[model samples]
Target: MGFISNVTGTLSDSISSELKDQHLETFRTDSLGQDILVKRAVRQNSFGRNQGSSEIISAGSKVIIPAGTYALMIDNGKIVDSVTEPGIYTWENSSSGSILSGGVKSVMGDVFDRFRFAGEVTKSQRIYFVNGLEIMNQTSNESLHLPYPDPVYGTLYFKFKIMFSFRIVDPVRFFKKTGKATTVYDYMGSPALPKQPFTEVQDHMEEALNLCGSRDKVPFPQLLSNKSKLKDAVNETISEVWYEQRGMVVESIAMTGLTLDEASRKRVEQFDSAKIFADDPAALQALVALGLTKAMNSAASNPAGAMTGFAGLGMAGTVAGNIQNGVSAFGGQSVTGPETCPFCGTPLPLQKPLEYCPACNADIRSYFQGMS
Candidate 1:
């Protein structure tokens, strides 16, 4: 104790006996409230003015530190004490400034002693509560050009959209980079900066893609088909680089869209055309025969002597339609054959062969459609 006699003499000389106009210092952070983060009022004197805010701390004042919030006590813009634990604390002049100190109960005698004490307050006293929840979210408005191999096109450029979320994990680092040490701020605090740092995230994601070397294995023509794998690979890369030292955690990353460039789009269209021909090579070879069949079907539609030129074509087209529709089962039984599973010897799940059977992991495509 720094001479109780001198402390008492100083208090008696400075304060008045009358308690009518006496102001007690008290400060509770908005972060210590029900919301994830809260806003405090400006100083009483500066209520309507843009001058500044005042932090009040008085003896016996109750400090409530809530959950999911990190509270700090700043003396003239410098952090002096912090309270990470949620609890109620009453100030006593003689006790240490830090909230978790054990000496508070032993030193504080009563309201009179508490009133006589003036410990937590300094030349400039303020309390700040920072939300620990994940609030930072970023989305790529423009698609990133993702380069990948194309089996047919060699190299393809695909645009990708990304969404990511982050949380503040370190209070000290956050305070340093945020606004003025004295001002209160939130997720979108800075006017010049975005709510989240998307540009940095994009760079990290690109680096990850380069490291994974997915370009070597997949081609641009087949890029859209491999979307799931691409999303996973990029997400994994972001997780590793989202540093905790920045006092933030990257919570989630999602790939929302993938689109091809004009050249690649045209190439894909051509590939689809080639695929159609390859799938039905016989039809392409038999185009003249098909035209004749179509002419026969048109003549059959009218069934009149006026359609004399298309009479043969109409007949051939009708026969062709019947042959195309005839391959499947007419009633319960197939005119072609039953689509039985080759493996478990059960009927196929659907009329046509699917990738696999639900009941017994059998490849239904093994059974030919036209075999009796």
Candidate 2:
């Protein structure tokens, strides 16, 4: 058979074939390196060739690590060869030795020694194309439930929809922990990748989610109001986790939506409705009094709206009297003296003028202060 047909057709697909020197030099992925997602949680790549994708690096394949690509050779589940820099490289049966000891210079062959590996090219070696791109594209959407604190409502559970980008800073560590690599040979024909690396990636995001109640602590009410700063905090907090784990460097993250649970949603609705009244009862009362005054003034000018307002007030007063009478008639007997709360008309406890009404949680002491 001619050398062209032997190298081009037969050698490309067959792992068992012995590689010639020319084939070794030119062998590489058709495209650049790839982003291989780690979803298995098992934290490792499979042994030899994924047939699913378009690219699969067969055994005895020569590979050149293209620019922006980091390639590795895994033999029997061990990383035996790797090319980090952009260059042409042949995957030898053994490493040249560590650069620190100067063993690499001797192992790197002159132009002539490339003809043989020992005597012939080693058998059954695979090449993995790793994207040296600074940030890894997210393989899937990430959602998490995180605890967020609020000054008024305490801690609220929030549903965070997060998307992040990262890069492989330490390929060896990533491989050691994740055990994931892709070649052009497998079923997929590209790199055999894990299903959802972002899932494990979320393990590092807890501190950012919990907020530790500091470092841009976002209240439930302000979740949307203060999104930009909150995302920054999430990035800062999650970045800390990646740095410690040496898993991957977090390039950037975006929180698309931060939502509240059912209970928190209700609480926020109540807060929106009753904010002025809850924050300052006295002010609420003053506003009512002012409305009544306007109604009385309108009675002289145009008696219709005023008559309606006065009639409403009369019914309200009658309802209030009935409620007070009922409380007095059926409620518990006074535990303390006549320091009754103006709001609940409940007897006060030993907390004195500043005490709160147990029945209604009214600030009896503040009421008394106002009276004085």
Candidate 3:
């Protein structure tokens, strides 16, 4: 029979306490830490070894399920009973027909088969407590590099570390899928558990970041502050693997130590320098004047006579003056450039047509293909 729920203080006082220490009656778990994912329940009697299922769990036995945990009873290598709510339960051994009852299916053979004896199912009975508290893993030290579309800087490669917290939402699925039956399942310490899902998250990082950059309009540098958007994007990408299959969900994700790669940083600086002269006619004229002074010095040192050098220089000076006159004809109005990325709506700092949209990495060739 499955474990039956018992109301508090409902156990009758008429029962005799004559043979108290002979068999284990009560099962409960001690304090569980944050990182401990699962632990086997402790039988009340410590001195005597439990030789059989009867000695381990008997009729009229009590199971104390505390808050923030789930308890499941394994009988004959199958999970026959479980209690998700926090309460006292009474074990009734009247019938075995309730095997795998209470909406919990039998434990998958492939997972718990290793505990069987010589290819035979044992009569062993035990209860395991799965931690229900939120489990926070260590901050991943490995850097995740992704292409980010910045309004001001265009497309930039961002390098950052990640941290996240998850919790077991379905104990049955978790126990069935985990395979290993350790006395205590530590989420962070598990070799296979952490790597598979985290690697999936890393593999899908680019897709998620693209969603943030394009759909959410989140800037590259603001990701650290916009934890909710980043968390949602990642969860949406890996939900099938982590939530649907594994019965766990990423509750929160923090993107930390965010920075642009060296090449991307230099590109931003170069763009900014060029953008200043492209927008400001006065600044461009000043720069042109400085170049002319340097050219005049080189012309005086020419092997050709100074008069010939001056004559050529005078022609160049006339061209420079005409360009300055054209600038003045604009009535000192500031020169304007291309303002935004066509694909993702990110602001553009440069006026000239680019081969690629910096914000979304969309090929600009298609946008300008038929232009004059």
lDDT of 1 by residue, 252-353 (tens): 566567777899888878877777655664544465467665665666675466367465555555544433343222322344335444554344535455
Error of 1 at 32 (Å): 9.3
**What do the candidate models score in CA lDDT, each in turn?**
0.50, 0.50, 0.64
Per-residue lDDT of candidate 2, residues 108-148 (tens digit): 33111323332333332344566656543453344678766
Candidate 3 lDDT, 187-207, residue by residue in tens: 444433445556777788888
Count clashing pairs, candidate 3.
Answer: 0
Worst 10 residues of 3 by lDDT: 9-18
lDDT measured at residue 182 in model 2 versus the true structure, 0 to 100:
45
For candidate 3, the per-residue lDDT at 101 reads 31
lDDT of 2: 0.50
Off by over 4 Å in 1: 1-62, 75-122, 140-143, 148-155, 179-196, 211-245, 263-372
For model 3, name the residue pairs that clash.
none
What's the true lDDT of residue 11 in model 1? 56
lDDT of model number 1: 0.50
